[model samples]
Target: MESALSHRRFGSSDLMVSPLGLGTVKLGRDKGVKYPKDFTIPDDKAAADLIALARDLGINLIDTAPAYGRSEERLGKLLQGQRQDWVICSKVGEEFNNDSGDSHFDFSHRHTRQSIERSLDRLKTDYIDIVLIHSDGRDEHIIQHEGALEALQQCKQEGLIRAIGMSTKTVSGGLLAAELSDAVMVAYNPAHQEESPVLDYCARHGKAAILKKALGSGHLISEQDPAQAAMHFALSHPGVTSAIVGTINPEHLRENAEACQRALLQT
Candidate 1:
C-alpha cells in the first residue's frame, strides 16, 4: 500500500505532508479526554497495527504532544525503522500529570528548550518536522507575552525543528501565529466556524493551517456519514494544509483517509 494520498506543501517549509494526519492523543492517555466514551489504551501490538494501517492508507503526518501521556515514547519505539516515512508534529508548553490526571502549562524560554529536547529523545528522532505551542486558552497572552513561539524559532534555527507555530484557541491568536510562524493548528468544523478568518489569513499569506477537532472532537458522530461530511467541510477550505483526526480504530482511520481523498479531489 504505497501512499495514494497527494502531498501538499506545508506552508513555506521544505517538507510535504498528507492532508489527513493521524492524531495520537488516544494512543497514550485515556483519562482527561473529552471523547464521547471512555476507551482503554491499546497494547503495543495494537498500536503498531494502527500506525502501519495509517501509513498504508496514505497518512504521512502524526500529531502528538507531551500532554498526550506516553504517545511520544510509544511512537519512538513503533517508528524506529520508518522515521523518514512520516512527518512528526509534536508540541510543547503543556504537560499532563498522569498521577493527578491534570495538565500544567509552561511557556518560559528554558522550559521550551527542555521540552523540545525531551521530545526529540522520546521520539528517537534527531529533529521534529513541526513543533507547536500547546496553548492554555490564553492565546493572545501566550504569543504576545509568554514568548513561547520565539523559543521555538530559536530551536528551528538550531536545526532541532523544521517548522514552528501554535495550536491557537482563538482567531486573533491563530492569525498572530501565522504571522510569526510557518503553520497553525486551528479548530474548525461545521459546528464551529469562528476561526474561519484564521484560515482565510493562512490562505492569503501562504501559511499552513492544520485543523484540530475537525470532527467536532467526536461530537459530530451522530451526523450521517460524519467522517466524510466533517472532512469534506474542513478540507474544502483552500487554507487548510491538513486536518488531524485522532482515532485508534482501523476502520475509522480508513474512512477518514478516504473522505479526505474525496474532498481533495473535489477541491
Candidate 2:
C-alpha cells in the first residue's frame, strides 16, 4: 500500500516533506544527549540499513547537524548515489566537540558561512534542502545580534541552501524566525506546549513549523504505543509541518512512521 502520510509544502518553499522526518542525531552522536538511556552509534552497514528502512517507510527528510557528531559525514558516505531521494536538513551555530563532549556556539558571519560550506563538503552535496540555526538558549539575541541568519539568507540567495530558518528555543524567537525565514523549528509535544504559540503563528502566517523533541526527548514515553499517542498530539496541531524523530533503531523507526501515518489519518 502507498503511504498514508502525505507530504506537505515546507512553508512557501517548493520542498515537499513527509510529516515525519528522520532525525539523525543518534546515528552519529552518543554523548551529551538527553535521552532516557545511552546508545551505541550504529556502524556504517547498520546506518545504511536504517536509512533504507526510513526510505521504504516513505520518509524523505533527514535532519542532521554539525552538533550531531559525524552525522553529515556518515550520511555523505551512506547516501552515495541516492542523493535525490532525500531532503537533508542541517544546522549551524553549535558545534559538538567530540574530545571534550562539550558544545560551543558561534553565530558570527564568518562561522556561519564556514559551517554551511563545511556541511556541503561533508554531505558531498552541492546544495542542502534546509539549514537551521542551532540555538544556544539566547534565541532572541541570536536572531537579532548574530549574523548566522543573514549568512543563511545569503546562502539561499546564492543557491547553496534551498531554505533557511532557526531551530528556535523561545516563543518570541520562533515568531521572529517565522516572519523572516521559510520555516522555524520549535519544541512541541504532550510534555511541552510552551511553543504552541509559535505553531499557531506559523499556521496563520504561512510559515512552516518543524517540531523537535516531539517525544519530549524520550522522557515522556510511557505505556504501550506511546509514540502513537505522542505523534498524534504533535501532528494534530494545524501549524505543524513535520516532526523530527531521532532514532537509530529500525523497529523504532518503523513504529514511528506508522504512528505518524495513523495520526495523519485521524486528524
Cα lDDT tens digits for candidate 1, 1-267 = 534788889998888999999999998998799999788889999999999999888789999999999999999999999998999999999999988899999998889999999999999999999999999989889988886888899999999999999999988888888998999999999999999999999999999999999998889965378888888899999899999999988888888888888888887
lDDT of 2 by residue, 60-142 (tens): 99999999999999999999999998999999999999888999999999999999999999999999999999999898899
lDDT (Cα, 0-100) at 124 in candidate 2: 98
| Clash-forming residue pairs, model 1 | none
Per-candidate TM vs. native? 0.98, 0.98
The lDDT of model 1 is 0.93
Q: lDDT per prediction? A: 0.93, 0.92
RMSD to native for every prediction?
1.2, 1.1
Show where candidate 2 strays beyond 4 Å: 1-4
- TM match of model 2 to true structure: 0.98
